[model samples]
Target chain A: MSKQELTILGRAADDACCQGLASAPLDEQRAADLAKIFKALGDPVRLRLMSMIASREGGEVCVCELTPAFDLSQPTISHHLKLLRQAGLIDCERRGTWVYYWVLPGVLDRLAGFLAVPHSAKEPV
Target chain B: MSKQELTILGRAADDACCQGLASAPLDEQRAADLAKIFKALGDPVRLRLMSMIASREGGEVCVCELTPAFDLSQPTISHHLKLLRQAGLIDCERRGTWVYYWVLPGVLDRLAGFLAVPHSAKEPV
Candidate 1:
C-alpha cells in the first residue's frame, strides 16, 4: 500500500515540478492527494522523525537509534514512523532485529519545488 | 493573537532559510512551531484557497471571490482563510464589506527554501 501511494505521490510531484502551486490552481483530486503528504508532515513528532532520518550522514538510520532521541515510548515513535512511510516521505526495511529508515530520494526537493513560487509570479503586478 | 503568531512563525522561517530541514536535526521548539504552519496547509480546502490567492494576477483575492469557488459556506471558507493567516502564509484586510487576502511576501519561497535539500546532502555516501 505504501509503495503504491509513493508512486502516486511521485507522479503528483512530477506534475508539480512543471507548474508549482503559484503557477495555477490545483484540481480537487490533486489537492486531496497532496494534502495527505502535507498532513503527514504536520505533526511535531513526525517532522522531527523526518529530520532525524533525512539528516543522517549515511542516508539511513536504525529504529533503535531513532527511539532513543525522543521522550515518547518506542511504540509511539514507531507509529509516527509508520505515518511518514504511509505519506510516501520515507521507506523502511528490516535488517536482523532493527528496522532502518531513509527519506525517499528527492522527495523533499520535489515538495519544495511544488511549493516554490516562480520568479514571474513574484514580480509586482 | 494572530499577528503575534505570524511574527513568531516569520522568525522561525527566517531561521529556517539559513538551514533547511535536511541540514540538521530540528530542535523540539522549532519542529513544533513549523508543524503548525504545515498543519494549516495540510487541508485540501486551505491548499486550494492558497493556490487561488497566490496565483491571482493582481496578487490578492477578495473574500467574495473566494467563496464561490468552493462548495462550502462563506463562513467555512473564512475559517480556512483564518488558519492560513494564523500560519503566516497569508494576510488579509477588511475593505468595507469585503476581506482581501494576499500571500505574505516571499513566504512561499521561504517555506520552499526551508524544505529544499542542500545539494551537498544529496551526494552518495
Candidate 2:
C-alpha cells in the first residue's frame, strides 16, 4: 500500500474500533486483504519462519542462517519466505546474493489488537 | 486431551519457551494440534466470530445474539462456532435453548507470546 493509502486505512480502522465488529463488517475488499495476510500465517513453515525472523537477535536474520535451521530444502524455505514478504508481515533486503528478513513491528500488534479480548475477562475454568 | 495430557503439554510448552522455534521443531503431534487451531482462525467469518465472542461485555455472548450480527445463516454461524470450540479457543455453555460462548484467555496470549518479538524493537519505516 502507498503511504497515503495506508494512513487512510489506519485512520479508518482507528475510527471504527469499538463500534462492535458487524457495526462495520469487514467489507469484501478488506476481508480479502486481511485473508491474504492470515493465509500466509496459516502454514506451520510460515509461522516458524515468522518467529525466527521476529525473535532473532538484532531483530532480523539472514536467509543463509534460516535455511539450515529447517530440515526442508532451501527452495522450500525460500518459497515460505516469499509468502511472508508478500503478507506484509516481514520485509527483506538483499545483501549481495543473500537476503535478510526482519519482522515488521506493530504488524503482529495489529493482529493482536484485532483479536484482543476486553480487559475484563475472568479466569477460564 | 485429558487434564493430565493438557497439563503435560502446557508444562512442556512452558519449559521449551525461547529455545527458539527450531531449538525444537514443533514435534508432529504438537504441530498438527497447533495447525488445527490456526486453521480455524484462517477464515474471515471465524475471525470475526472469535472477535465477537472475545469482545462481548459479559466476557461471553449468547449464540442467538451472535447469529444476527453476521450476514450468515444460523447454521453457518454454528459451524464457525464449532470450529472455534474445536480449536479450544472458546468454550460454550447451554442455557435452555441458548448457548453462550466465552474466550479462553491465555489461548490468545499463547499465540501472542509465540509471535512476540524481543522486548525491544525500534520503529519500522
Worst 10 residues of 1 chain A by lDDT: A1-10
The 0-to-1 C-alpha lDDT of every candidate, in the order given, reads: 0.86, 0.61
How well does candidate 1 match the true structure in TM-score terms? 0.93
User: Across residues A18-106, which tens digit of lDDT does each residue of candidate 1 receive?
Assistant: 77888898889888878888898889999999999888998899999999999999999999998888778999888888789999988
Candidate 1: Cα lDDT at B3: 65
Per-residue lDDT of A1-125 in model 2, one digit per residue for the tens? Answer: 21223343343334333332323345544544555566677777777777667656677699898888778999999999887776666777887887788866567655544444334433343
DockQ of each model vs. true complex? 0.84, 0.24
Give one digit per residue, the lDDT tens place, for model 1 in B8-123. 89888878877888889999999998888899889999999999998888889998999999999988998999999988999988888877899998788888888997566565
* Every model: Cα RMSD to truth: 2.3, 5.9
Off by over 4 Å in 2: A1-35, A117-125, B1-33, B118-125
Q: Which CAPRI level is candidate 1?
A: high
C-alpha lDDT (0 to 100) for residue A112 of candidate 1: 92
